[model samples]
Target: MSSYDFVVIGSGPAGRRAAIQAAKLKKSVLVIDDRGSVGGVSVHTGTIPSKTLRESVLNLTGWRERQFYNRRSTDNPQTNCAALNSRLSKTLLHEVDILEQQFARNNVHTLQGRATFVDKNTLRVERREADRTAVELVTAERVLVTVGTKPFRPDNIPFNNRTVLDSDAIVSDLTIPKSLTVIGAGVIGIEYATIFSALDVPVTLVEPRDSFLDFVDREVISNFTQQLLDRGMSIRLGCSAESIVLDENDWPVVTLSDGRVVRSEMLLFAAGRKGATDDLGLENLSLEADHRGRLEVNPKTMQTKVDNIYAAGDVIGFPSLASTSMEQGRIAACHAFNAPMPDAPHHFPYGIYAVPEISTIGYSEEEAKAKGLLFECGVARLRETSRGHIMGLQSGILKCLFELKTGKLLGVHVVGEGATELVHVGQAVLNLGGGIDFFMENTFNYPTLAEAYKIAALDAWNRMAHERSGKVIKLKKRKVGKKAA
Candidate 1:
């Protein structure tokens, strides 16, 4: 038996960050993961793998170049499962190696095993070597559970990993089909659907909700929807999968509740994901996970019911991006060790890597209206910029919202190329409490997508000036009418 200051289970983004943070504080840290390697799901199956695959598809198929060329020929490069797998493999290996080295340098010990709670303070890890099985019991002053989540596989869906697959299997199997039917319009489904569609494979996206990406700004969503439609992807809204059956040829035929049948060479069911906590023996700690297998934690502190135990990332649920998860892990480690935690910003940017790409931070017009905030909006189309002309991008938008009275920037939303990377400028302003004036005052590099910020700011400034002038004229008219009366 060995004892340490902190023990982190599952070396995903959250676990890795927490362990390293604690170790940096000179605390003895042990990280336990079943995968036999660092980087966990984020590096292996989820974020890195999917994003790398998207980049590979875009590069290999000349997706970005197609806007200008418009040439369709057999000589054009095509991507297959092998090529994508090769890229994903290389990327994952590099990421894992970096994480492993980081852990070693920080003096954080890592054990490859499945971790189960012996009690609130102790963990029993099971490991298997080539010819022997071993068990190790480790005690810790604090524990962080960051096991992440797995794709929800419903029994009704016949997943053969060839014709039909879940989100995880889709990346591993890596087959390019003639047609694909993706169930669930969530982030994962939308990403894969668009990736395959970009490859010129007919894709049908089915969502049970009437709205797609409802959390995103409606304007951004509208633009993204149009981009998908323009790319020839079929979107079926407010439709649920009644059943998935195989035809005589053994291809998947998805029956919708709306009396529609969609037959595709392959199917991807990415409805949702559940936390990977089934084997952690939470019952021993008297901790109850939600129906989705997610553990509840204090939003600010990331602490569970047990004061010393914390949870982060997908296992804790909501805003499960690698970026946010890393922050959560750092905050959790800080709280666990009683370190001074910095104040987190009220707003964080959300990035969706769909075909056209969407990124947003702060409030949307609809949200501002719902909250009864006095707000005005400014809009700029990418086509209005020089960069858009050079890149042949006709469809892209940068929308900015400002509070009418104070001229404070309420939100920034963007859709189209480079939206994800370009959103950081908005995030910086929002975090620093800077308003529209910041964009108007600063000079962005000319002929760049970033210049859209300045354009949007000017639009809002003009609108505000016009409204103010109109109000003054109305006041003068009212005074004149009162004097005549």
Candidate 2:
């Protein structure tokens, strides 16, 4: 038996952060992962893999250069599947090496095995080496579960991994698919669909929901949809896949509930992901996970039903982002050690790494309306900016929402090139409670995307002033007419 101050299960963003934070406080920490690698899903399969592939495709195919130069100068066979896969392999290797060094330098111990709960404070880990299996018992004063999530696989779908694939498997088994069909219009589906579309592959996106990314600002979604259509991607909304059959060529033929048929060279099912917790044996602690295998925790402290045990990352659900999960793990570790938790801002940014990307922070226009708050919105198209012209961008938008009565900035939403990076400027202002005056007074560098903030702010200011002045003019006209009569 081995004992430690903190034992974190799963080495995803949340688990890694928690283990390292606890170790930095001089507490002994041990991280156990079934994969035997330090960089969890985020590094191995999810975020890193997808984003790196997006970049590789863009660079290898000269996506940006083709905008200025002709396609003849950019298109080549070197940007094919083999080259893209090679780039993904190189990037993953580099990331894994860095993570391993970090864990070693922090003096955190790692074990390779599947972990199951023996009790509230004890875990039984099963290790398989060659033809032999071994069991070890480990106890810790505090335990954190951050196993993350996996793609949901329904029994009805025949996932042979040859013609059909899920979100996780597609990254590893990628080929230069001639035509692709993607199910679901969530973040993952839209991202992959657009990425392949950029490669000039015909992509059909099917979603059961009528609206795409309803949580995002409608205007931003509208622009995104238009861009997808302009790129020759087919979108079928309010349509569900009734069945998928393989044709004579082993290609996937999908039948929609609406009686539409889509034939493609390959199919990707990315409808949703469920928490990875079935092997954790929560029943021993009398804890029950939800239908999706998610555990509930106190929002503020991230403590599970048991006092010493905590849950973070995708296992706890909602806003399951690598950026946010890292913070949750750090905070959970702080509360476990009775240390002061750092003050976190109320608002956090969300970034989707699709082609022409999308990112936002704070309220959406619909959210402000649902709350019944008097607010106004200002928008600036990327085409209006000098940087947009230089980059040959035809479509992009930056939107700002502000409280009508107070003039305080409430939200910032963006869609287009560098949308993820440009959003921080608005995020800073929103978090600091800065109003229209902040952007008006600030001097942004000329000929940059950041200038969109200044343009958006001015648009809002003009509208507000026009409304106020119109009201005052009406009052003056009434007084003059009364006096003359």
Candidate 3:
């Protein structure tokens, strides 16, 4: 039987990262996955595929041309799905190949098989290839289970290959509908809506909520809503598809909960994702999943009920991005080895790949109030910055929250160009326990979006001054007056 110091199941972001981290520490590692390829959903269905399509749409359809030059001015403004798919596929495959090479360089053994828990210290690995064979495997003392999530498909929906599709199916070029109906206004839904809409395919987005992106700041969502509307996308919030039927033309006809009937060439259910822990004999190990089939991991160490078996990524659920999952995987591996590692970052960024991106780190405004902390909000619109003006940014905003009493930076939220990139500044500040004073004193590049952090800090300082009572004002002046003044 093959053996290693560490065996990571599922070669996704979390598993791959965990293996790499362990390998870096001179641990023999084996990474097993069911898929024939590497890089997991991030490379295949989720991050790379979507972002590549977004970029392809922007370039081919001249969406970015509309920034400085109008689409009408482009020699060829129309885009085709085949072209976007061809490019996206090529790039995605190259990325997966590179990741495979990296694993090889690190001497991490990748086994193409399905792994099942024989016991806490043993696994039964069924190898799948030209000559299939079952092999009894002995598990390592430390195991990292980073099996990610899969797109949730509900039984109520009639999901025929032609008329209805899931997120994974859309990655293939087979069903590029002329007009599409997308359910769920969460990140995936909004992203697909924007992508298809950008391709000039009429898209109708339905959500069973009063607002889109409710988790994000309201102003940011409003701006995104405006952008999507401008692109000729239809949004129906507080409405859900009661039933879906295929027309004689093999198109999808959906009846909403509000008694509204909508027809589309295709229907995409981006409802959400569920953990990938269903079939790995989790029950045998006495591990249980919640309603969403996600493991309840210790937020501190990411260990499941069984201390030796650690879970990370979407399997554990929430903040389920490739970047965060990578970090969690590395941390889990470190914890498994009992390696001396620094504390996890206090603030982690959340990125939603909608038309206009949304990203945030740290506490939300409501969370601050719920915690009964004295806080102030600072806001800056992208239009207010010269960089935004030069880039033709029509709508985008950055909001910062700070602890009023101690001047500690609480949160940073943004929706606009480079929202994901801009969140790092806030992350650094939050990690260091830096406050509004740090932002106000620092000088950012001229006419840059990063200036929003400074502007937001000043805004918070002004509000803190206004909200403080006489006694509080004296305390603030005595401590932070030099910086604010």
Rank order by lDDT, top first?
A: 2, 1, 3
lDDT of 2 by residue, 1-485 (tens): 99999999999899999999999999999999998566889988899999998998788667776667755313553457878888788988898788788899999999999999999999999999999999999999999999999999999888988789999999986786889999999999999998888888899999999998887999899999998998789999999999999999999999999999999998999999999999899999998899888999998999999999999998898999999999999999999998899688999999999988999999999999999988888888888888888988788999999888677889999999999999999889999988876776667787899888878876876677755654331221211111111
Q: Considering summed lDDT, which 10 consecutive residues are worst modelled in model 3?
A: 474-483
Off by over 4 Å in 1: 72-79, 469-485
Instruction: Please estimate how well model 2 matches the true structure, expressed as its whole-model Cα lDDT.
Output: 0.88
lDDT for model 3, on a 0 to 1 scale?
0.82
Candidate 1: C-alpha lDDT: 0.88
Candidate 3 error regions (>4 Å):
72-79, 131-138, 464-485
Clashes of each: 0, 0, 0
Cα lDDT, all candidates: 0.88, 0.88, 0.82
The candidate, 1 or 3, that scores higher on TM-score is: 1
In candidate 1, residue 9 scores what lDDT? 94
TM-scores across all candidates?
A: 0.95, 0.95, 0.91
Please give the TM-score that candidate 2 achieves against the real structure. 0.95
